[model samples]
Target: MFEKFRKKSVVSESSQLETLREVLRRNPEDNDLAKVFPQVMPLSAVSSAWPGPIERLGDLPFGVSWALADPQNYFRYVSWDMSRKWEASGTNWRGLAMENLTELSRRYPYAGSKKGADGRPFVLSLLNEDSMGPSRLLVPGLFQDLFGDDYIVAIPERTCGVAYRNGLVGEEALLANDLIDGCFKVGTEPMSNERFDPKRFWVL
Candidate 1:
């Protein structure tokens, strides 16, 4: 489903340069720029690097790894799906004791009852580039426009936003995702089926 769509945008090279400048401006004293922008730029930097619809990822988790691998591969957001690793492990990964996250999404990206100390329910939402407004920018506001307050983590390149209900923040939700027994990570979001065109500013 995700593969069928194409996100079109004429990225202004100048705009990207400006965006990077703005982010670096936050900390002018840092002598080493590499320290600030690590191997995989933090989720926050991804938001800041582009001057598009989505300018920032407010409180997303740290597990996200979307950095510009090679300048030649411009406009491509390098993605490493932890879930895919499990998918490769066969039943050992997919057959976890948890719910079939993929199946739950078939109906509605809703939540279940409170399970942990935080008294929160796991919530999942999707932010799609095809459905996103004209700019193809995965803006933070887009999550609110779509799933309201239930969203947790958002993968802009994949164009999917995940959330956990109640007060369970991204960290807690991700923790629960790992700790819960018999829990299978849901394949609801479009982590796959994406191709990034190096020549273009858009990832299709």
Candidate 2:
């Protein structure tokens, strides 16, 4: 039933990413990603075991630099977006995000959704420390609450808990953390201050 999405896995990140890109390339219909995150293709592979590449700190996938960045656009490529099947189920993620953002915009004033890719709805919650209001915490849950839609709250470098929903797997999140954690020295932030390809970090 969930043909348009992939969930958690136990494989290596490189292998999964390669398989995902290959599947999307072969299918040639998931052109929606070309608009925003053209780097991320679709997936059809089911294997959960892969021989990961030997990685180092310099070789790790650099996450988006949170230093003086626009959280609105930054989040569009990261937050929870509904699979088409789930949308057909009548749970519209974009609508919910817009509604919540509309209400939250009354105070935060920096919430919106950018359609860089198709199918995936990237929700933005940009607020300063002073106005860290409900939207920061509530919006993600509201979007991910659709039936059969599973997600996890991930705080990238003290930023808001941007929901990593869409077709992302918990294993991918783990791989990201593992790569960053294993690379950096103790206590150093995994979400780096340098921007890297989002496709290298997570497979959507």
Q: How do the residues 63-159 of candidate 2 rate in per-residue lDDT, one tens digit apiece? A: 2210111335432221112234335677543344445444543545333333323544333333234223222432323443321245433333322
For each candidate, what is the lDDT? 0.31, 0.32
Best by TM-score: 2
lDDT tens digits, residues 124-181, model 1?
Answer: 3343222221112222232244435444442333334333343455666565344221
Report the Cα RMSD per candidate: 18.5, 18.2
Q: Candidate 1's C-alpha lDDT?
A: 0.31
Q: Estimate each model's TM-score.
A: 0.22, 0.24
